[model samples]
Structure formats: C-alpha cells, structure tokens
Target chain A: MVEIATIVLILVGTFLMFVAGLGITRMPDLFLRMSATTKVSTLGMGAVMLAVVIYFDDLVATFHAIAIILFVFISAPVAAHVIGRAAYFTGVPLWEGTIVDELRGHYDLRTHQLESVPLPELEEHLPDVQVLKVLLPATSPLAGQTLAQINMRRRYDVTVLAIRRGDRMITNPGGDAQIQPADELILIGKSAKLDEVVSILRGLAR
Target chain B: MTPVQGLVVFVAFPLLTIAVILAFVRLVRGPSLPDRVVALDLISTLMIGIIAVYAIATDEPVLLDLAIVLALISFLGTVAFAHYLERRV
Candidate 1:
C-alpha cells in the first residue's frame, strides 16, 4: 500500500516540477514567469517530501520532511517579493499587454521613491499633483542646456517628466539629457507650483 | 536491486533529470535578473524533490535531513541575491 502511494506521489511531484519549468520558459515577462514558477515549484517539492516521509515510515524522517515542507512554504513568497521589488526598481519592463498598472504614476524618478495610496483621512494632507505640457522656446535660457545645469528639482522642488521631441517621447530623461529648442516638457508637481514649473521650463523665471 | 528500488531508480530519477534539464535551459535563456533568479529558485526546489526520492530509493532515511538543509540554504541564497540586486540597481 505504501509502495503504491509512494509511486503515485513521486510521479505527481516530478510532473509538477516539469510543469513549472515549462511555465518559466513559456511566460512572456519577468513578473509573469516568476509568478508561474514560485508556487508550482514549492508545491511539487512539498509533495515529494511528503512521499519520502510516508515511504520511510520512520519518526525522524517524517519530522524532518515536515520541517522542510513547512520551511519551503514559508520562505518562497518572501523571496519572490524581494526579487520583484528589485526588478521593478531596476527598470524591468512590464509586458505590453499588462493592464491596470497601479504603480505607474506612483514612482518618482528623481527621488526613486514609490508612494502608497494614502488613507481617506490622510489624503487631505497630501499635496495636489498636476501635469503640464510646455514647449521649450528656441530663445529660452534653459535651452541648449542639460538637466544637471538647470537644477530645477533642487531650486523649485519640481520633478520634470517626459519630453516630447518631434514625434518621439523621452521618459525618465537622465541628468545629462539636454533641453532642446521646441522640446515639449511634461511637468508633474504640486498644482500650486505649476505656475513656477511653467515659468522655469519656459524660461519665464528670472 | 529490489523491485521498488529499481522502479525509483529507473523511473523517478529520469523524470527528475528531465525536469532539471528543462530548468537549466530556463536558467540559460532567462532574460532579466529576476527571471534567472526564479530559475535558480526552481532548480533548488527540484533538488529537494530529487533528494527526497533518493532517500527512499536507497532506504536511507537519514538523507532526508539534507533536503531540509538544502531548503534552508536555497531560501537564504535567493534572499541574498535579492538584496544584492536591490542595492546594485
């Protein structure tokens, strides 16, 4: 009876392991692949461990296998979470077909911070954010200048956003990125500071 | 070898070997840091499965302890890799 059970259990476990490998290869993006393998592999390993405990019919072996199973269940999710956060911050792109991205606007490139949605009571305390589209005039003071030279963030506390140059959009422009004539800058910041942001990027600030 | 041992050796071990090879392919082909990390995690989990089966086939219950240790080590390795990635990027 134990032998038959062992055979069934082992086969099921190994099969699931194979399925996990298949998932890793077949999934399109990083997040999808990680989600596929973590739970499947952990469960497959657990099944095999239980098979060993049953087959051995020994007290020590049962305890050891159970302990291993428990540990596997406990640690896999935490490890996956760590990797996911690291990958996201490191600029791993989400799959194109991914819908409902809650973290999209929450990340601030300058601060490298992700803000969680505040509670209803705390929402009143937060600053109102606004996005503005401004065209950099050819004769502007900030033109022919890189982001580092302007010091917009340090001086006015405004984080610059996407810059539409011609038909192309540049998101997360680096410090060395030069402001060009006729480039459209997408500025996001406190609504109260929108005027200041426009004044600075539009070279209206003296 | 006994019938049960023979079954495990010929059947279970080969299946595990195939699974490991498949995971190794993912480890090589994985594009991002997270993809490679997940492959490594899956391979280690498969190793625990192999250890358990081997323990039964060899009739050595003591080897089960090694599976326990491997589980702990693999989890720590994953967490350590994650920390490095978080700081490095």
Candidate 2:
C-alpha cells in the first residue's frame, strides 16, 4: 500500500515539474518566467521530496525533505529577485505586454537629474574620469591602494565618480580614499578605455 | 517491479525528463544571461523531482540525501551567477 501511494505521489510531482518547464519556455517575460519557475518548480520539488519521505517512512528522510523544502521556499524568491533586477539594470527589454515598468520610470528620473547637473560642475566635483562601477575582488591590486596612489585618472584615463561602500555612498571621495574589498566604484570615461581600466582593477589584488 | 511502480518510473519520470530537456534547450539557446540563469534554475528544480521519484520507486533513503544536496548547491550557484551578472564581473 505504501508503494502504491509512493508511485501516485511521484507521478503527480513529475507532472507538475514538467508543467513548470513548459511555463518557463512559454512565458512572455523574465518576470513571468521566474514567477512560473519559482512557484511551480518549488512545489514540484516539495512533492517529490515528500514522496521520498513517505517511501522510507523514516524520520531522518522526512526531516531532510522538510529542510530542503523550507530552504527552497526561502531562497527561490530571493534568487528570482536577483535575476530580474540584473536583467532590468542591464537593459533587457521587457515584453510588449508589460503594462507598467516602475523601475524604468525610476531610473529615467534619476538619469534626468544627472543630465540636469552642469557638466563643468560635475567634472570639477569629481577627480577621476568616470568609467563603470566594478567590485574589487580580494586579489585585485587596487584592493589596498589609496585613490591618489592608484592614479587611475592618469593611468587609465578613468575617474571615480563615486564610491558605494555597502549601503552608503561616498560622493566626491578624497584622493587619499583607500579602495577596499567589495566596494563598488562608479567610474566614468570613454567606453574602450574604461574596459581596460576595469580589467586592470579586477586584475589587481587577485 | 510492480505495475504501479512501473507506471511511475516509466511513465511519469519520462514525461518530466522530456520537459526538463526542453528547458535545458532554452538554457543553451538563451539570448541573454538572465534567461539562461532562470532556465538553469528551473532545470535544477525539475531534477530534484526526478531524483525523488527514483528514490521512491527504489525505496532507497540514500537518494533523499542526494536530492537535498542538489537543491542547496543549485540555489547557491544560482545566487552566485545572478550576482556576477548584476555586477558584470
């Protein structure tokens, strides 16, 4: 009787998992795809894990299954959020069916504010040529260097527009400001030159 | 194997495998990084279900451990990939 019940549970779980895959392929947008995957796939996995617990009728397996299910429930949404936010920031266009894009509007407003600022003043306020924001790996050479010592503006023709240290921003940082691991640097410069600067920064400390 | 167990191993697992394969194809052909990441995540979740079915049909508790480990590794991998994509590093 337990065997038969196990078979029934497995079948149902398999069917739901298959449906999740289909939804991922057919969904019109990244958000929709993530929605389908997180909801349906997590449930499918939970069902299958539950089936295993039933098959064994053991407390250990049951506890393991429960742990996995709880982990999935907590992590799936966070992972989806990360993916969706990355796609949005990288300028991946949404499907036409999207009725509203709050992120786009918010970004546009911020860009407009930046554009309104006078260029001369912006340049005067910042020391380094702005390139792109990049994280400093532990191995990067710039990991421990002060802004003045790195001389990024003279070396790579890239300026540091701002420094994002965790949740706080250090705007118009001093020349003596030291770079640290996990610090995100907002740089600005010509595109090709910025790429080189980025490579150099990443290659540092690593 | 009993007829009922056969029904699950042959019928249900195969159907789920087909679906997972389709999603894998999408992961390979995805135009963007996020799309591929999402597809890979879905595939990993589906794989957990497939493994569970195998454990049940065979009545092996060991396979349950494998399923739990796969889930944790897949979740961590997805988060790391997403972070890489977001920072473009």
Candidate 3:
C-alpha cells in the first residue's frame, strides 16, 4: 500500500512539474506564465515532499517535509504578488485581448491602493493647454456635427485636435470633418474649458 | 529498494531533472523581469522536489533537513529579489 502511494505521489508531482514547465514555455504573455509557474510549480513541490514523507516514514523527515511545504505555501503567493506589481509599475504591457484593467485609472502608486477620490492636484500640474480625449456616444448632440458647424473653439474655448473612429485616426481634421457616433475626440484647451467640453460631449449637459 | 521504488527512482528522477532544466531555460530567456523571477523561483521549488526524491531513494533522513533548510533559504531569496524588483531595497 505504501509503495503504491509513493509511486502515485511521485508520478503526480512529476507530472505537475512537467505541466508547469510546459506552461511557462507555451503561455503567450508574462502574466499567464507567472500564473502558471507560481501556483502549479509550488503544488508540484508539495506533492514531491509528500512522497518523501511517505517513502521514508520517518518522524523527523516528515516534520521537515511538512515544514518545507508550509513555508512554500505561505511565501509563493506573496513573492508572485511583489514580482507582478514590479512588472506592472515598470510598464510591462498586457496582452491585447485583456479587456478590463481595474487598476488603470484607480491606482495610487504612492499609497499602493485604489482611491476613488478625484485628484484636482493632478490637473493643476498640467499645462494651460493640454489635450484630452472623450468618446462621443450615439445619443450625444455633438456626434453628427462637423467641426465648423460645432464651432467648438468659439463656444467651448476648446479645439478638436483629432478624432479616433474605430482603428483610424483623423488628425488636424478639416472644418468639414463630421463627428461620428462612437468617435473618440481628442481636444486641447485650458483644463477648465476641457472639463466643460467633456461634459457637453458626454451629453451630461442640458 | 523494491522493484516499484527502483522504477520510480529511475523514471521520475530524469523527468524531474528535465523539468528543472526547462524552468532554467525560462529563467534565462524570459522576456520580462517578472517572468525571469517567476522562473527562477520555480527552479528552486523544483530543486526542493529533487532533494525530496533523493532522500527517499537513498533512505537518508538527514537530507530531509537539508530540504527544509533549502526551502527557508529559497524563500528568503525570493522575497529579497521581490523587494529588489520593487526598488524598495
């Protein structure tokens, strides 16, 4: 019975180790590879240690194996977290297919947490004329207006720098360039003016 | 050693060794710093596996203590490297 158990543990552990190696090699992105190596490889170590404890059936050996297993279980996740945070801070790009980044606009690097409070100080640091982007929803009044017809500069004190529609971008668009629903407009002006323009473009205004 | 144990020792050791080597390859060739760190941590974990298997094959209980010590030190190494990566050290 012990021998069967030993064989089972060893084989399973080795298989997990193999899977970890395969994952690291085959995964396309860094995050996926980290996910594979951290969790799977640690479990493999635990399995192998279990096999050792069973095979030796020695009290001291079992204690030591248990200790090792516990330590690994405690440390591996923390280590992975630190490394992943560093990777993110160092600007490692995510895979193209990754859609939601909860940390994108919410992270405060100084605090190392997600803060929902608006940061007016950040806007204060910006230049008097800065470019901003706002998406034009289908219901937005500005969606179908051409640049000349909207007269953005005269009314809102902002200039439309460019329009991003789908994958294409129109930079320095002519007066006749009509804004489309779902177009992302890049605007430039004073910070306050840009804020007003954003509200208007978002259809948050009367 | 019985036939089953012998077969396990011979067959599993080589495969675990290959696993360690594959992890080492990732440690060296990984595209990003975190990728390399993850691979490096795995190599140490695999080494722990190797130590455990060796202890069983040799029936040496003392090696199990070595495995425990290795685990502690490797954890320290991982944590230190992580701190370094965070530029906090």
* TM-scores for candidates 1 onward, in order: 0.69, 0.64, 0.68
Residue B14 miss distance in model 1 (angstroms): 2.4
In model 2, how large is the Cα lDDT of residue A103? 42
lDDT of 2 by residue, A101-134 (tens): 5342223222222122235665667554333556
Candidate with more favorable, higher DockQ: 1 or 3: 1
CAPRI-style grade of the A/B interface in model 1: medium
| Stretches of model 2 off by over 4 angstroms after superposition | A1-4, A107-206
DockQ-based class of model 3? acceptable
Worst 10 residues of 2 chain A by lDDT: A108-117
lDDT of predicted model 1: 0.80
**Mind giving the per-residue lDDT tens digits that candidate 1 earns over A36-113?**
788888888888887887888789999999899889899999999888888887878888898645565455433446
Compute the lDDT of residue A111 as modeled in candidate 1: 44
What lDDT is reached at residue A154 by model 1?
A: 84
- lDDT tens digits, residues B1-89, model 1? 86668767887788778877877888998778777888888888888888888898889989888888888888899999888987785
Which residue pairs show collisions in model 1? none
Worst 10 residues of 3 chain A by lDDT: A102-111
Candidate 1 positional error at A112, Å: 6.0
Score residue A66 of candidate 2 by CA lDDT.
Answer: 83
